[model samples]
Target: MHKKILLAYDGTEEGRVALLECADIAHLLRAETHLLAVMRVPSGVFLAEGFVPDTVMEDERQRIRETIDDGVALLREGGYSAYGHLACGEPVEEICRLAAELGVDLIVLGHRKQTSFASRWWKGSVGISLLERAPCSILVAVGT
Candidate 1:
């Protein structure tokens, strides 16, 4: 029984599908829902420049905040009470950290299929990585 669920929402179409699935599961189990949005600074940005500008970082944070807020609002509109959380860093790391902190029973995420093998290989997979490090069970909702 999932008493608590953490959903990693990125404000994308794929994310929306995961959100819907998570809502249904949460409704079924009567679980507390949490939405997390991570703000990640590109490694290339740090490599190109010695430091990231405060304005740039702030802008990214604002975007993430809005994204999380929107997710929470959507859940609320759907009659689900949910908590929103925001963090800055790697997505997988942030999700794991929040799940541990919240003591969530399950973590939900959206998966976007990559058609090109090279693109998939170069970018790696968050879902695969989460499987190795997540503290609890994970559900990856794939969009059609």
Candidate 2:
């Protein structure tokens, strides 16, 4: 029943695992797959006292673009119909917006386990936020 699946890939180890799982599910369902890499703008860029060079921002964007391209290639090599997308914004917001825009049936994410309670509390959880705000179903693949 899942005709359109969106995979959020960040080129991390966890993300690669999620990509494999998403590819398998997509193939099983004969669904079209889309790989998304969200490029988070550095907080320094927004702070009045902080100075971020244009070159640094460009380099980061290029890296994210390469990651998305690599993820799409991996999916295609695995025999799934797939394409790559790049979004610039907060990860949760970009993911939700893209899912809604594409009218996707499901969104898959790779979740890295927090090692400490403090870290979890400080950074919050993207998976949790997605569960609450995503426009479609979400499948989170936690790294072992």
Candidate number achieving the greatest TM-score relative to the actual structure:
1
The local distance difference test score of each candidate is 0.92, 0.91
Report the CA-based lDDT of candidate 2 relative to the real structure: 0.91
TM-score of predicted structure 2: 0.93
Per-candidate TM-scores read 0.94, 0.93
Encode model 1's per-residue lDDT on 1-144: one tens digit a residue: 999999999899999999999999989998999999988886666745588878888888898899989999988888887999998888899999999999999999999999899988998889999999999999999888
In the range 1-144, model 2's lDDT, one tens digit per residue, is: 899999999999999999989988998999999999988778757657576677888999899999998999888888889999998889899999999999999999998988999999999999998999999899998767
Q: Pull out the clashing pairs in model 2.
A: none
Q: Which regions of candidate 2 fall more than 4 Å away from where they truly are? A: 45-51
Candidate 1 versus truth, CA RMSD in Å, comes to: 1.4
Error of 1 at 62 (Å): 0.8
